[model samples]
Target: MKVFIPLLLGSFIFIGGLKEGFVFLFSLLFLLSLVAMIIGLIRPSLLKFSNRISAMKVLFPVFLASFLIVLITTDPVEEPRTDQETVQEDAVEQKETEETENAEEQSEEQKNKNEDENAAESKNKDNREEIHNEEKENANEESDSSSVNKQEEKQQNNTENKNDSKTLDEKESDPSNDESTNESTDSESDKRPSNETKGTTATVTRIVDGDTIGINLNGTIESVRLLLVDTPETVHPSLPVQAFGPEASSFAKKTLSGKKVQVEYDGPKRDKYGRLLAYLWVDGKNFNEMLLREGLARLAYVYDPPYTHMSSFTKAQSEAVNAKRGIWSIEGYVQSDGFNAVESETETKQSNNSSTASTETKTSGSSAYNGPYNPQGKDRNCGDFDRQKNAQAFFEAAGGPEQDPHRLDRDGDGAVCESLS
Candidate 1:
């Protein structure tokens, strides 16, 4: 019974170890126990003691209980997979890997396209800015060009106006037409003085001298000699520059140059030299009287009768004479005929004495009835007399043919004051 019990436990243990996938050591232990049980059954005397009734009976039940406990606690093994199912799973994994690769490629391509678009947009923006700046620069350049053109046109117009004014002056002063007009006017003025007191407006274009200016009369530039006033000979052809001449010219330039004035006509319209004879009024004040009042001019050229402003001009001259200003400052400088070039008595004596013998010889034949003639008095010139016959009479009285002290006959023709009307 003991041997049978041990043998049954070993068989159940070995089968349970293999079926439950237990360790090889448990199978080896089951085999060893089975061998031992067989040996014990076969040789009972080897296991028993001298006094033992049966040792197997005591150990066999314990071994059977241990094997039963091990068998009850073990789990069953799982079944293995088939080859076809494994192949299908590998195919599904490969397809998923390919889809993931395609998605990544699409994302990379979209990123590159976005970068290209952004680059193109930035380039376009830069181009637009450059074009806008260029346009602005061009506009500024055009504006500058337009301004330059306008300035040039304005300058050109001013130049043209000046040239036109000059041309008109030249045409009016032409010698061809002036001689006939002056001759006719001189004859008429000598017969009867014109009472034309009507005034006209004119602009002074240039200061010709202290008592003369070039005026723009209705777009025509005419040389205007201030009526009833004579400044020092600054621009005379045959005379030297007299004292205070430049001062008088400077005063005229300051007072009348570039100024609009009123031109009041007197007895004559023009002089023998074709210069217009008019009284200049500046700001409602008589410029001619102003010159005399300032001592820049002397009241002279009273050849014609009935001068309108003669009284006023004489008053202005009296003021300057009383003040002893300008020409009046010099003693014996202002005279009846004209200004004396020499102020020294010695020079005057030398001049008078040098021609004395010749003067006596020439005056012996002249029948002088006497129209204010003084041989040994103040110097006389052609400007002192009103007519040519009067000057001739004075020249004859002063022995002009042999010795001309006053130098009335500039051409040495023995015809005194031929320039006079």
Candidate 2:
């Protein structure tokens, strides 16, 4: 009875477990069945009637049990579209993750690329600096070489000058010179003349500044600075040195810096200093004239004939002086206090005093002019007249009139400045 009760309870529990899809109960049942078969084989008395079923009778029940087992154990076949959709969702999620990882990788790659570019730029900058340093070194070397060449040339010229001087001294000392027999007097004269002629044109070279220049005119090397006209100083180390200095220097440089200038002999070809005397010319423009015109230089008219343009130059200087343009802009500039000042002020007075004086003058002329000068009135026309005078010139120019509320027709009664009405 106890065994039967246990068997009944176990079977009920097994069936209940199968309903819940529990595999443990089914496995327990299978194990129990195997044990029962083994016991039945070992001892036939152990087999129960319930367990020993007829084959034909059990076939349908076995088939139903098989069908139920299959129904419970086998997974349901899902529709192809639904399965595909789930797979695609998972695939899409994986793809998104992959994309995110790829994006991160790409960002890292771009960052590395930027770092590489920056490093390359830095390397290139360093290389450029090195190249610049090398170029500067080369330039310094070239400059040194040029300086050495110049020194060598200067030494050579000095040696030649010394030799020439010695030859001249020897010739002067001995009157019965060897050249008298060897060379004809005409030939000597011709040679000397040719040498002098060559010296004149050959010595003149190039102008360096407004004042000075190298020349190869007259078979000898010479330099002449200009005379009379004082140009402003350039090449100063300190700034704010002179107001018009650069302008003056530039003007001078532009006028005469480079040219085969004709030196109109001022006094001697040079002063006691042995420089050339000349008014410089580039093209047809005279340096002196330019300096005067630009107000950079004054016509230093101490001498005549040479100072022929003195009057014209002085006139230009006066205009610059009057306008107070360049040098004349300095404080306390002088001007002639003549009829010019009086007439100019009369035309344009800076004060209301002139306006008052004009009215008083008009009052003295005629008392019947009871118009603009009626200062004792407090009417709207009077206020309007004042406003019109303040705003428009036409009203003030003609003197105000009475009976106009707008007071716009202060001039010529019916006219309103340039307004047609």
Candidate 3:
């Protein structure tokens, strides 16, 4: 500890007139002083420099004063140093200070740079969101304009259709003026036959299904089915009849009983049923489109050319399903029927609670259309009715009750099926 003070004083003087030998001797003495201080601290009795403790304390103070005086007085007056070594030390210290200031400045600049970058990025993100919103707004405006135009066009068409219908009705109702009206209609039709195929020429001979009809083409009768649409059948003939089958058939009959239609073939001339599959034109409008717009049919084709009207068809179907129109109104189209054990547990609880239970229970939970009154029997308790759409479709395709490929009810309990019922 004593050496620290003396060494600092000597270092300043060492740069002056002090020789290397003198500096070395002074440094050695300072080192010895430190060793003595350490030894005194560790083992006070081992130190032999002073006798009495009072004398030693007083000696230390005196020695410290004398040492400071010697350092102050003995420094020989000499010329200031102009050596390369002195210049290098000053330069090194100045460079060090400059480096420290530069580091601090750099740290502050980096913090500001990060803040600016983040602000820019946040602004850019907000701009992108605003641009997206603007695009959406434009699209909505276009859609509204298109819808308004479509409505106006539809109203105009309806008016024209009603007028044409009335004209034909008037001509047919009055047999007296029928020849003159027919001659005028023929003249008008003849003028446009080359440009448009007149549907009135073809006479419908027989109705095949809701969508298909047999028409006298030239001389031979050709079976024509409307394209891009499907309708429920009284009996698939290819598949099977489903629920509301007769209603679907009746609706079709009422709509097209004696209507004239122009055919536009899209794909193969005929189906496996020898039916001409094409888009039908009625009153200059596509009947296939009418079925979809009326929510009476679903767009059935999924692949290839059918995709032309797929977007519009899908949109219409989505609207119908969302509105729960027609088949979509029927529950259990794609829902699941869970485990039987869980269902049985619930039924057992219900049975216990109910009083006056019937003796001829007949597996009351079973949905079997067996009895006379319950032709579509216990199956009516369709907790799983929501799943019937797909199930019914599959069953109809595989030949329902009459010719089912897999006898669903293996035990022959007068229940043709049981899996989902």
Candidate 4:
């Protein structure tokens, strides 16, 4: 019977795909059965059939609990990235690189062409000057001969041609004279690749976060990650929302949402995530620098080459940090490793007290959402019955389910203000 039982169980395990969880559960059961059988043999009087039944009743519940825990904690299998998607991404990157290189080559070729034209014009002018001088010498030495007169006429003709050539060159070089045509040319010059393409203007379709935004690039909508700035994480899948993240998101939405912006490429056109990397210019100001100056963002060190505004951005961040603005006001808000806001014991106690008051208000059937939600300030929390913007604010201030007995953080990644997030 024992031999047949194991054989039957082995067949069942194989049919179950022999998964690790199944194998572990089967092994535990098999060992327990063996131990029970041995104990019964060694002390038959102590472990009777009735005793065995009682023991199984206890063991079954423990076994079921263990199985449940394993099911809940085990990581699911991840799907593999498709080959087709990888190839497509690679092709796009290659095409963008080629276009940038072509622009640079074209600019260089244009410069060389202008230089050659100038050299040719100057050489022809020099030759005309030498001929005019020779004609003058002939006029001074000759006694009003017809050949001398013809030479003077030739000199006058050369002077007229030189003057006309100089005038045409000046007109071609000077664009300031024709205001209407200049305005039109200036508008198109944004996209034209000269020394560098002027910042291309685009309409902001959406603000993804404080440091990320969506802009309509020509006809296509592309994500643009801001250069030299990193705000707190409010929408990260793996990590919980950091303190002041919502404030940053809110600021970005208010300032940049649905606005037209100029996107200027600094280093590479696209980042590794296939998002366009650019500096955003709004109302003739650098938005990234403004965020730093306002103490809304920290300086990120993930810099690539040709970081033109790095020094200025670094200086702005220094000023913001020294001023103790926004997130910097919170204790232990480190710059290098994101916002690690460390609350002191007193602060924690105060926060807990506030949370308690808010909780009591909710439990006592008093409405916490009774007042107007003014989202203008930087450091607004959930306990402030003055304003409750959304569930995210409630969730963050409530400190989630563990801290927030109110269950405000539904998904529990510590994020609130869903509209801004």
Candidate 5:
């Protein structure tokens, strides 16, 4: 009965171990119990030790309890998965991985595309700005060209008119008859004021500045300040030579010096300075309008309203402002009262510094006067220097022929103080 009981318990444990994948100790215990059962059944003398002990009497019952315990504690083996279910799970995981990879690639491509679009937009913006600047420059050039053509045409017409007037005068002065006609004309002319005569032909004796001139009107020399125009002060009593001042003076000298101009008086004939206020027409072109169109002067001294040619003068100034010519080129330079000379002086100083630096290396060994020759300094005269060479050096240094700030080169010739020893 002991052997049978132990054998039955061992079989149960071995089956439980195999089914549940138990530890090695359980397998070993099952093998040992089977051997002991077989030995006791084959040899009766081997069962003598178990019979001598009272504990051995309950060994069958213990074996029965052990078999029941093993049966209760053991877990059932799970069924294996089918091939189709395993393949389906693998396919699902692969699909999810592919979707994630595709999403990442798409995000990277979108980022790159946005960056390229932004770069292209920036490039297009720069190209547009460049084109706009080019258009502005072309428009300014065209305006300047048009003004030059008009001036040329007016000059040609003036020449023809002058020739016709000369022919008429020659025919009238034939010294044959018309004494009574001449006496009637003289009596009619005596009724008008000589100094305030309108449309008087005068020879420009000297160009005082941009907007002022000395004219010989009927054998009388008079200082005429152009009406309705004010240029930058090159020779103001209180103001230092402002920016574009020298250029304005140079333009006047080049165009109106020694030329015949028709002086037309307005309501006010004289200014506070006792200078004649008139509109000078040079070669049939309004000289005041020319100065304003070139940006060399501003429309000013308009104390009297409803003046003739006011609309045309405003249009000329508008063109200059649009083109940013001369005084208009400097921001905030032209003010309501006058020009702001501070910025002009600063620019002049910077320009002079650069010019000096460039010429320093070239004039290092030259015999030219190395002394200070400030063009913007106090007015100098031919008597300021002792010798002709010294005067010439100073004049050239002070921009002599182009800019005679000191009036050293009186005749517009390159030489200065020519009579000096």
Candidate 6:
């Protein structure tokens, strides 16, 4: 009976165990029943519940029959999608595919357009260069012919003077002609000034900033950054406006604006920004060297080999510095270094997670922070912060110290200046 009960339970489990959740639960119950029945059979003296055992034997067949009936009636195949749903899914997939193809086509068309424009520009530039070369050749030929004509004319005049020598001798060296020639020379001198010849004439269109100007050289306008000079940065993109930056620019305007100047290139014709780098000569003076000499500018040391006017300009700048001129007059202007300050801030941010929790290096000695440093003092009481990000930002800005004026992360914890849990 025990062997037969286990075989029956196994058959019932095989039939209905694959149906769903409840089928597995019933299978587990049948397995336990089979185990109990075997134990009861092995030791009839152990199991005292005779009535319950007989009831289980009577219920097993009925339960197995019921399980078989339910398994036969249940459907196993998955439900099919409706026609409308299937159509909608197909439309979405097709739309996505078309969009991808359209994007690819647009990108290819843009690339082709860019290539065509570049080729057209190159061809135009080549044509312009060829035209310029041809014009230069024609001009050389004309000048050569004109010089030959002038030489012939001078020779003819000499021959005519020789032929007229006899008439002049008869006239007794004509005092009237001599007086007329002297009068003509005096009149010509009166019309022409002694300071007539100026250098390469360029009309100054605009002053870009201190030490920089825009001028029409020949016919084309070009930007000129003065060589051997760097004024206080007024129009600099990355620097704060300096106290004397305006004064320097005003000085440049008063000195050189609207004047015709001469450009003299040193080593390189153009700087990296394509500005013509030159010593601007205005009114018989080198304006580039003048800027430093007058203390309106500083002699920057960023020049290359064969530095055009390095020593002279450096001496000028040293004199300017000692005299406390222009930008140097401002107490902290010369001392203020935004670069080191920014670098210190960056380092503080990166080293925030260190075990010390404060900045790896103090801000005073390394950078331009200049904030009072007292690491052992009371909490500097930078106000409460809700978010850790804002606190960390302020902490970095406040010189990144655990015990500085703006206290952040007082407990020397990695989290600085915030109570955000």
TM-score for every candidate vs. truth?
A: 0.36, 0.27, 0.31, 0.37, 0.38, 0.33
**How do the residues 1-421 of candidate 3 rate in per-residue lDDT, one tens digit apiece?**
7999678567755765465435555555555655555665555567764444644464455545545545654557787787987999999999999999999999999999999999999999999999999999999999998797566555544543232111212333667444554444443322222224433345555555566665766666665767656665432322233333334455666665667766666544455334566665556655566565555666563322533344444445545656766544555331121111221343335433321132122224224332222222222232333454443443333334433222232222334334553
Better of 1 and 6 by lDDT: 1
lDDT of each: 0.66, 0.46, 0.50, 0.60, 0.67, 0.57
Highest lDDT scorer: 5
For residues 1-421, write the lDDT of model 5, one tens digit per residue.
Answer: 9899667666765885654434333444455555555555555357554442433343444445545555665567788989998899899999999999999999999999999999999999999999999999999999998786566455544543332111112323654323543444444322322334447899988776898787888987787889888788765423556777768888998999889988988755665445688888777678887898899998776665666666566656766877989988888787666777556566678545544543442244234556554444677776677789887877666554544556665544478778998
lDDT of 6 by residue, 1-421 (tens): 9999777667766875745534655555566556666666565345564655664565556567556755665568788999998999999999999999999999999999999999999999999999999999999999998786566455544543332111212222566534454454443322211232323678787665677777888887677878767676544422333444556677788888889887777665665345677777777676876777667775543434455455454445555656776545544334211111222333334323331332333334234332453332333344455566655654554445322223243433345745564
The RMSD of every model to the true structure, in order and in angstroms, is: 25.7, 24.9, 21.8, 47.5, 21.1, 33.5
Worst 10-residue lDDT window for candidate 6 reads: 335-344
Q: Give the poorly placed runs of model 5, Cα more than 4 Å off.
A: 1-198, 344-346, 350-421
- Model 4 TM-score relative to the real fold: 0.37
Which parts of model 3 have CA positions greater than 4 angstroms off? 1-201, 237-240, 306-308, 334-421
lDDT of 5 at 259: 97
Ten residues in a row with the worst lDDT in model 1?
Answer: 160-169
Instruction: Please name the candidate that would achieve the greatest TM-score relative to the true structure.
Output: 5
Q: List where candidate 4 sits over 4 angstroms from the true fold.
A: 1-198, 341-421
- For candidate 4, give the lDDT: 0.60
Which ten residues in a row are the worst by lDDT in model 3?
A: 334-343
